[model samples]
Target: MTSPTRILILEDDDGLRTSLRLVLEDEGYAVFEASDAEKALLTVEDPGVDLMLVDLMLGGMDGFSFIARARPRTEAPIVVVSARDRTEDIVAALEAGADDYVTKPFSVEEVQARLRALLRRPTIGDAETEDADDDVLTLDSRTPLLFDAGAAVLRRGEEEVHLTQTEFRLLSVLAEHAGKVLTRTALLQHVWDQDYFGDERIVDVHVRRLRKKLEVDSANPQILVTVRGLGYRLDTA
Candidate 1:
């Protein structure tokens, strides 16, 4: 029999933490719990750690710092779970290496769905498609997007443009349909999988994040452009 997928929950709130653990355990996932960043550090060393659910308000080290440190140690996807809904908080956590987030007041169903969505995302070093030459996406011959399937780094020329797992997945979709406008609904379905309970804003934030890293000029992007009332399309020109 295969061992259960392990999920580590790092949160300071006892009640919510327990509640999350119970719900996940009921779903047949083996869960490891920690009260703060310091404790969470130890769980990452375990090879069985399949994913992590973290809170930004963690007591000792705080979630942001934890994300920075833990990310380097583990390639497992990290999902930030917190009550903070500020766009800045969401963006910062993503920049800090979180694969996704869930605001507080979310249902256990939402948590389960997000976990499923994150897990469904391609693992590190996974090319967008098997036996496909489309892995390396480039534009303008000036800057090229190189995806090292073994390392999972999206590179421009020789420089590595670090991306969260979510960003990588989003870029992969855009690359597959380059020069074609994919609506927010299409993107959310392809990138987040079928069970994600998120809106177009999620798509928008990730695309903006991708532009900053993947484009030469994020303000007036040369590659990724928004079609008024339509969607986003990537054109090298």
Candidate 2:
């Protein structure tokens, strides 16, 4: 039998942490709880931790610091659960290496759905439909940037570029529908595998992050171009 997926909950609130643990456990996940960043860091590196739900406001270290510190230790997706709903706070969490963010007073169903989506292994093309040519995605024939989906690696000529799971998935989806304008809603559905969650800025923040890594000049991107009132399109010319 397959081992259960483990999730770590780092929250200072006893009630919220326990409630989340119980909910996740009821869903068949092996849940672990931590009251602060220090405690969470103790086990965050464990390979058993498949995902993490982190609270931004903690006792000792803040969530942003925990995320930045933990990001280098594990590739497990971290979802920030906090009361801060400002766009800047959300962007800061993502910039600090969080894969997703959920404001407090969020529904259990929505949290569960987000967890499920993050846990699902997204791929550009599985073995069944994969081709030699399909393995690599390039912005242009002359460009050195390449996305090797099969290997799950992005390369710029001889150099390998590192990407977080969310960034990689976003790029994969865009590459799958190259040259097509994909609205924020479409991207959220395909990348995060969720319906409207009321914040499209999540998409914009991630896209900006991707541009910084993929484009020579993120401010004047030539590849991932934004369509004024429509959306974004990957110009793989």
Highest lDDT: give the candidate number.
2
Worst 10-residue stretch by lDDT in candidate 2?
A: 124-133
lDDT over C-alpha atoms for residue 41 of model 2: 89
lDDT of 2 by residue, 36-124 (tens): 88888888865448899999988889999999999988878999999999888999998888988999889999899889888875643
The top-ranked prediction according to TM-score is 2
Clashing pairs in 1: 125-149
Show model 2 residue runs off by greater than 4 Å.
121-143, 194-198
lDDT of 1 by residue, 47-138 (tens): 54889999999766999999999987877888888899998888888777777788998888888988988787775466544433445555
lDDT of 2 at 26: 97
Model 2, 217: alpha-carbon shift in Å? 0.9
lDDT for each of the candidates? 0.81, 0.84
